[model samples]
Target: MSAEIAEQPAAARRTLERLMPQRESLRELAQGRRRVLLAARGSSDNAAIYGRYLLEVVAEVPTALAAPSVATHYQANLDLSDTVVVSVSQSGSTAEIVQTQQWARACGAATVAITNVDGSPLAQSADVALVTQAGPEVAVPATKTYLTQMVALGVLADALSSGEALAGDLDQVPDAVSRLLQVDVAAAAEALAVADQVVVSGRGLLLGTALETALKMEETCLRPVRGYSYADLRHGPISVVSEGLLAVLVAAAHGPLAEPMADLVRDLHARGARVLGIGGTPTFAELCDLHLPGPDLSEAVEPIASIVPAQLMIEQMARRLGLDPDNPRGLSKVTQTEFAG
Candidate 1:
């Protein structure tokens, strides 16, 4: 897994940059679409939530996220016209999502496939394929692939909303990711070693990352976890904070809520929650046990940098707990919802 993550930067850049030239074509296909429907499961589904938000806020387009089962069984009468279905699948061959894509296409909607595999069933099936360059993911729970998917989809949303010029600026993302991967994990691990519970929070696209981080901590580190928005934390979530708990916040750089979110971090510090602010130029580096470096990309684009630190934190915490990340809790590499003999 270490070797896999090590080799990913080069491959990720190659795969992502290859799609830059085609941004105009994709944007052209997406322009003025009445509704964009995204479908997936697991971490891919979480990424799709952010994709829907980015499309709506950045592109000024209406979008919704649906589990494949919703369109396949629950709501068969879904409107198909002027709708583009973007299916995100790491394998590009998930039975349920593939089945859903087929259903959407049959209903006359244009389909776009976003995946890690180029020649996989999803790419072969869609009207256009947007491939992520995350390389091979040996671990069952996605890490880098999830980050790349967010990057590809966020840039796609920008292109679809504005123009090709926006995508050219996107080539700098790999460099930002590289910097983030170099963040000091030693400090973060030491902090986590003593923490009893961890609170993860973010706004907009980063919100899903907070959830993903919470899941990683629960599954790998055996840590108590909860996730919420930066603003929502003040409502009631912060009441549980103590000297033994860690508060991790993802503050976006380009979002309207960015500053207030930072202010919330400061407030958390005053209230005694040890806050580790993940995004943007953090004001209190010495106060934060761990400070990750990042580029000031759009709010939708901040996930790439924010996710790596969470991955490192989980990996280190797992090692501390004496658990093998490759196979957690005797869980198999793959699981199914149904099987046919």
Candidate 2:
């Protein structure tokens, strides 16, 4: 698992190298599309959230994360004409995801499969396949595959926006991730080592990062963790958050979101909550009991960089907790679910 974590930088770089050549074509898939529906499960779903923010904000296109069961179980016939359905999966073999891509195509939507495996079932089904080629992810919890998928989505967004948002500079991400791989998070992971629960929060794009962080912790460390947007975390979850609660805030997207996140840190501190800030913003980092400062990058690409440190921290936590992250007890690398039409 740790080896895969270390491979993230090179894996992301390779994904960029492969996808950039196809950017014109990838963007063309969404060209003239009225809306986008992203479908995935687990870590890829979290990456889909990152993609959702990028598509809506950067590409200026309306996007929604797909609820596969709505089509599969509820049987609502959605007219997806002129829409794009992007399915993200590590193996590209998830039954529901492949089926969703197929049904969306049948329903008149352009289809895309972003998967690590080339020519997998989902790839075979989509109009264009953005294969990560990140190689086999042996660990149950995803590290490299998730990062590569986000890179693929970013490439598509860059294409759609005519290189405005990302500015044809997605290549910087791999080095940024490489820098984050060296930061020490052993102290933070150790401090929270005994805690039974952990919570992560962020606003806007990093909300996806927060959620992914929580999921990684739960998957590899075998602890109870939940993530929510900055506001939603306060709505009800804050009621139980008193002293000694480990609260991780993803506020280092290097934009307007950082100040408000610092405010959340103060609020949590006032309640005696122990805070861990993820990002490089000085104001926010100063307030946290622990801080993981990833490379400062455009908000569009920060998730790819920032999440690396958290993945490393999870590896450390697994070691401390004396558990094997690569083979978490109740989880499988790919989860399969299908429904008959």
- Candidate number with greatest TM-score: 2
After superposition, which runs of candidate 1 have C-alpha atoms over 4 Å from their true positions? 231-236, 284-290, 296-300, 330-341
Across 81-138, the per-residue lDDT of candidate 1 in tens digits comes to: 7888999988898778888899888877888988998898898989888888877788
At residue 34, what lDDT does model 1 achieve? 76
Candidate 1: clashing pairs of residues: none
Q: How many backbone overlaps does candidate 1 show? A: 0
The residue-by-residue lDDT of candidate 2 on 172-251, one tens digit each, is: 89888888889998997797687656888977877778899999998888888988988898799888888868998888
The Cα local distance difference test for each model comes to 0.73, 0.85
Provide the clash count, candidate 2.
0
Give residue 97's error in model 2 in angstroms: 0.5
Model 1, residue 139: C-alpha shift (Å): 2.2
What clash count goes with each model? 0, 0
